[model samples]
Target chain A: MRYSKYFLIIIILLSVFNLYAEKPFKYVETGVNTNSWALIPAGEFHFGQHQHIKNIDYDFEIMITDVTNEQYANYLNEALEKGTIYAKKDTIWGYHPGDPFDAYLHEWEIPAGDYPHMPINEPGLRLNYENGKFSPKAGYENHPMVEVSWFGAKAYADYYGYRLPTELEWEKAARGTGTNDYPWGNTVKRNQANFISSHNLFAKMFGDVVKTTPVGFYNGNNYDGYQTVEGISPYGLYDMAGNVYQWTGDDHPKVHYRYMRGGSYQSYEYNLRVWPRNSAGPEYTSMSLGFRCARDID
Target chain B: MVEWGVKDITVKLLGLDLESVERSGRIIMLYHVIAMIVTSIEVYMITSIVPMRKHQRTNINATITVGWITAMIFGMAFAYFGHNYFYHGLFLVGQSLIFFAGILLAVTLNPWNKHFLVENKEYAHTKNGYDLERIAFFVMTVSMLISAGFGAVTGSFWSNGHETFLAEDLIRQPDKTALQKSIIGYLHIMLTLIAIAITLIVGRWMDFKGKLHKFAMPIMIFGTLVISGGVWSVVWTHMAHTFIYIGSTFVMFAALLLVIYAWGKLIKDRIKEQGLKNPSFGQKFVALFHDPIKFGPFWQMVFMNFTVSGVGIFMAVKLEEIFRVWPAREERITLTGHWHIPAALIATIILMYYIDIAGIKGKLRKWLGWTIIIGSDIAFAAMTIMSMKRLFVTEYYQTPLVNWTMLATDFGLGIILILLAGVLGWRLIDLFRSDNRWSKESASPELELERTAVLTKQGRDVIKKEMEI
Candidate 1:
């Protein structure tokens, strides 16, 4: 009995020794710049359409970065496979008498696996391109996917139980804590961001073009270092100016096509301004468009 | 005449709207003084009382007293200077001396050592004088020191804000420029997490042993350290001085009180049973007050520790969020509110105490203990919710009076839990102390009992190692 007590003590001592010597698991280094996703301490910041709705305010939590390939893939796979749609048409009646299947239905293909769950023309879906469909055979998994339609992005988010970043959320994250005309600041620079600063549209062919670099590639020069590649925003989101234009959930009349902010690598310098609105058709998926995602606090 | 007071730096840095730092600091000092006095008295009792009665274990009592007193003095000095490195160094030296002495005592005191082993080699059956207790003690002590050293070096809390002592160039500001603030915040947070990890190890050690005593000591020590640090910081610093001071002091007092309560068991043994049984009420009262429950467990010791510790931890979490905002809010990784695990463990200990008793037999005792455990769990959840609501929601305005009232409610809940736990522990201890043969068998018989005892000893050794005691 006495000997057993000693034995038990020895076992306990050994166990304690083992616990003390243990170490924690290491997170993988993705090599992606994290500046755009820098943490904003808990506090309030102004939110709204900076130019158009100057007097109005709509507060929302914004993501520091766009849904990366890793996070987006999870949502895309889950939502598209299960066939759950977040947005039904907000119109009064089910459909117009002369409409074919449904305008919304025609815009999105939320089949089991083939399509994303976003709105057909939403900018978020513009970033879900794989190897051959969007670009030539130069697609890196870590690189943002492009060519997904707006509905495709919304459908993908809805399928996976997420929503398109509302205009308020999107702008807040993009222009974090600042009223900048672009993600970096009011003034634009050539080397600081990836927009077509030289204003030569015929400089490079589509296939032979300089491909978009990974997010936060130019983080060193980000004006605030708290948001994106060009850095610094009122709500602290990256790439809000020039990396790629993002489509918000809201429709705008000034932007006759769907609205796209954040000028792409192929865009002219003027398009890089935060207030400059532009859009593309639902079927058109370009390499110069991509998006970020946001979630509700609750 | 005014006693020396620590500057309320916590309020300055954290920007608390309520409570002045100076007032909070004084309260903290009072608690510290009370705890120190209680601990000293416990040390005195361990030296003077136990040895006088338990004649067979006189040597053990003497060694424990000397070791404890030395550690306490060393720990106090270290706390006074706010130098963890020095505290750790002194702790190691004191613990080593105790270990060496224990080993010597085990060998010299063993009767078999003189008769066989070293003196006679002709007897083939004779073995080397390997005292398991000695080996376990030494191994456990060394392991404790090793783990503690690792925890101190690699641990986050040790590194957190230690830069204050690191270099003249490196700034240790509660509030710095945004750039400097981010860096400091990240480092400090990381360190605090590491300290928490180390503390969890102490809990894990207790879980491994299943013996309440082994785990209790480490918890007490950890609680004491945390409490002392909180008290010191509340008094000394200017950054976040008032908010941190009040919150930390509450946490500190709770921890110290728990340690004393757990140790109250030792005082109980000395008072109720050891000091000439069947004495007068006055004599008992005198013993109780002098050799109070500071360094040992009271009859309901385990539960008191649990409730105090559990609620203290929950409150501490709320306090932490109030003082500092998470930099990674977008990530949705809020680091707070993990006190439930310990609360559960404490409840388990109390229930187990009841399980060991004969008075609570069959399904009824099991049902009662379980009911208490479940009830306590519910209370804990409610406490957590209340604290969170109080801290996060601006609509629920908590004045100092209301806050104190809520805190008192938490303490009240804890006391109730302790009462239930006490019922169990008291019953179990009663069964053990009795000459109840059937009850003894029910607890564990012969080989099973031996195995359990051995395992407990081994488990304690491992726990000591884990604690870096």
Candidate 2:
């Protein structure tokens, strides 16, 4: 009986050590209500093409889905209350000092007195603050947060002890270790991503409600009641092709514009390729723009 | 300067933000208004200038040529505004009106006189006339080149990077590299200079009767096609500035070609034959109607008319909530009227053509013409009244009076249209009275007799000598 008890105690001790040792690599950060991230194992990736082609090596953990409106609002409210971040209404003004991207510092605040009010669970509330509380549009809490300036995205990343993914990191996660043009493979299919199609003129004319479908709306494979496959990148990142354009940590070579990766709901199919790159002014904000956070695997 | 401020106020009152009004909006508005005025002046001048009887045929051809050029300009402006500022109702209306006016002018000023060339023989190859024509062509070419140069240097071609008030949320700074800007600028200037050089060559060679004339036609046609291809490339590749410069180059060449054809009669004279001589106005009109596909200028006018009407109605319907021109009832009425008027006119034209083909004659043909005239007038009057009611009587005028000036101007245009319709109706009546049949067997003899009756003794002798040859 004494020997059996000793074996049991040792097993328990080892279990505790294993949990602690695996803590930093875990997809979910402790005490944070953010979505789970996927690990991008350390490896070399073929980055860019034409004059920009190069091999890039990176190791990081990136969010499986883009940062949701609810999580961003929660972080914004917390940072505002703690006096760590300040908002200047109706003006877009902010920048990340140490960022290597050389993103132009510009203003991008939502217009003052124009915030819509809805229950925190309403779908169309977008970004709104009323009566000392910040909330996403009511039913769209799960939708990707958009209209956030590059600086705003960076600020949220900083507050959460994470950083925006570098252009190389983003492309590596999207293209995986292979040279596939898209997350699914070389060929693009309509069902693979949301995009504007010339064949569906009627839908285009009327404007489809499916313009920005809920995150993980397609290409999801459920395994044991968990979304584990379908529409997933080789690195297990969801929405690595299209949902919203994700801000990356690189600047365009000839301008004060930051690089954006993947594509948005309004993008054409060819534009969603992992090889194609686009850039916008850092202060640019639109309903089709958002960001996902990444952290280095220490 | 005062008018400029008024334009600013007008834009401000149209619901644009102050920043937008001050930036690109005011400038675009001024361009639209200036283009309209210039088109009007050109139309008036073309219509009013009646060269001597001998030069009348050439003048009519010149009118048609200018009309086509004006239509092309409006078409380009329409495409530009539609691609860039489609959401702006005021600009949409302005562009549509310019297109509509172009078609109206083309139709009204179409060359109809049959004996104009024979009458104006004295003016042909005259040194004084050549001097005047050369001087005018030089001035026009120089002006076009200078304007294109200015546009290229001012970054007008770089439309993609232009900053606008409504687009302030997404600031597009100037292109990153000075080399890129300079390259585009230099290319634009070079193409413009090439266009000017070609114009000078074509104009000078058109007066000659040798190898250059044979080569000119093929060269101009090939150059136009190549330049048009360049325009498509620039637009597709998103080289915004290059698109403008290339498009202007195409326009300059097209205008030069038209000038040579209309004034010098280089193409028509080459193609002329014995059977094609002294065609009556009715025969000419029928020929155009039967083979509209071959009539480039006429087809262009038809395309512009349909586009203007369709786009005007679409804008009216789509922007109803924003413009607030009329109540629900009047809006529906106006929308229906807009569609029905064009449909009715087309139906009338078809009906008249069939009747004429069937050899309908006497009072029956005259009655049909009168019926069409009355029906079109009634439809036009209804449209005008509805427009006026929307402007003055409707309770839902969201914009101020300054902003309503476009609506008022459109209403005034109705009178001009009614008068034009009357003139066309009279022409149709005259056609019906002159000949009940369009058979070539009957038309040839009638044309010869009509020619003999109309020609002077010298003209008749010249025709007899040509026949003997």
Candidate 3:
């Protein structure tokens, strides 16, 4: 009897100890894409000088862009084909996302691996403006696509088996190499990138026609004459501050929405600021909205 | 540490006011020690006063009365000390005396004295007045020193130079000195050690002496409560409020039941008088199945069916939902709830079978007695499992049915365990008391009667010649 009592006491104490121990939080990594991006190992980075949190400062290497459309599409296709839906959903959402609707709204199809079909002529669909679907306009396939909703972006990414970037990652990329705001050292100049004040939204038969410029065409005002005028995010990415305001995966509770980065052609100087954040519903889509990709590595 | 008796009780006589905590501690310690010694004397008399010569009764009665008076004085003394400290002192004293007496009883009343035989020669000769004074004295002296030592150490920090009357005040101060804290720490370890020692001694005695009825339950309770009390005294003396106080009082009452139980055992052993004669197997075993023929198997089946049907249905339905295999609410309301019907039917059929079999007169005559004994035991074990299952179910679902069922089952199990323990104890006592002699005349009464008849016939001629004059 004494031995059993002591034994029970010991067991109870052990279980209580277990209850107090630290629990490891589980997180899975698959940046919004089908194809695996090169793992960006954690390291130091030269972020904005004297502008970051003081006293506790360190440079951290982060994914250069938000997770992209193509990568997510491929992951979804692979997962569906491999009969790995449970894994695809479990490591991401605890439930499955219903299939996406088609252009005619006639059917919902679970997209095949890496073969996501971009909707056509939808009001929010990003157009290859340089090729104009048929006419030779400005902006083409090489340019970053736009008009994706935050929800659509996350679902698309999860479908292909990837995750959206955290708010911290988006901030890191926007900060670029310097602490200055628009990835251009606190300067907002028309000579830097395309904006409503500098670029056309429509190139019609009228004078001073408003239209999107071809990708990398802001050559006359090359702030850093690199391989291409568009490929500079202050931290060196193509058209980060002024291409299409890119959709980020970061969600803010009070905002009840996520963020869009990079000013649109119709945006003002404030909108063009690298730190400026705008809320968008997960389902919001527009011509001047797009996203980039980031990958996580241990 | 050694508090012999009350001293410096007259507050005015001490040349100081009665508001001194130090004086209070001293008074309380003294009271505790005296009370424990007196209680120990009563316990000792109960065992040793039995099987006595004619004149020993007066002395034994006087000792018991004095012991009772001493206990009353100690109870009053607690009012003077803080309730917390006083109860701690009381229990410490009470448990110590009981622990000593229990061990002594286990040693003296052990069946081994008769080589486990009810009719051994010593069993007939050794009537009562068996004194374990030496062991009793040793335990009492040690327990007093340890309990007083613990009280002193625990009460030290509150012992400012005044006799604090308010119990709450003495317990509230938190900034105790390191020396005072260490004393409290040692007291816990000491109390635990004593409780454990008592448990071990009684447990071994029960196993060797076959006193499972008289001793095992009390020993188990005493050991468990004292250890728990020691732990609580160390951690939550001041924090224990009215509810805790009342709950603790209830536990003490339970402990009192154990002491009462021990006293009853001494009398039943006829330790003070001639030992009771052994009963024959037929007389004993027949009493088990004689009247009102207890067919416990019937009741056991009823309870078993109730338990299985209740829990099995609940688990099947609830777990099916958790696994997402249950039909939708609408479907369940109409169709799927029928799944529980078959198990319910099976349970009913099993219950019916038991009732039918146990109700027959021939069957009761043949097998009813053994069925009840074994069936109740099985039922007890099954009920304990059901109780645990109900607890698990309530943990998951806070519905009214589950909550009420859990409480009901828990209480049911506790009752069954205690009742079954009683039955087992009675049977064991009967086993120990029965004549185990191997002589043919002692073994079979029928054969012994036949042999006596033959002897009488053979001696008839010699008997007639002797009676001729």
RMSD of 2: 22.8
Q: Which candidate should be chosen as best, given lDDT against the real structure?
A: 2
Interface RMSD of each: 24.5, 21.9, 31.4
Task: Tell me the spans in candidate 1 whose CA falls farther than 4 Å from its real position.
Answer: A1-59, A80-139, A198-208, A221-230, A252-257, B1-469
**RMSD in Å for candidate 1, one decimal?**
24.9
Give the poorly placed runs of model 2, Cα more than 4 Å off. Answer: A1-34, A41-43, A49-53, A87-125, A197-210, A219-229, B1-469
What's the TM-score of chain B for every model shown?
A: 0.31, 0.26, 0.26
- The residue-by-residue lDDT of candidate 3 on A183-268, one tens digit each, is 55554455456675554322221113222333444433332232123334544454556756666665443223456666766566
Tens-digit lDDT track for model 2 on B420-468? 4764675567666645333442332111111101244554566578779
Off by over 4 Å in 3: A1-120, A123-139, A159-162, A200-231, B1-469
Q: State the lDDT at B469 in candidate 1.
A: 58
TM, every model: 0.27, 0.41, 0.25
lDDT of each: 0.40, 0.48, 0.39
Per-residue CA lDDT of model 1 for A120-176, tens digit only, reads 333223223333122112233344545545655555455445566655555556555
Worst lDDT window (10 residues) for model 2 chain B?
B445-454
What would the per-residue lDDT of candidate 3 be over residues B1-469, giving only the tens digit for each residue?
0111223455434332222213435454554454444334333333332222222333333444454454445544554444555654554455444444445444433322321222222112123322122222233334434544555555454434322231221121224444444344443334333323332222222121223222333343344444444434544454423333343343334333333333343334433243436645554444333421322222332343344435444554565232121112112221222222222222222222323322445554335344434444344334334333333442112233333544653454445445446544644665655452224322321211101001123235554676795
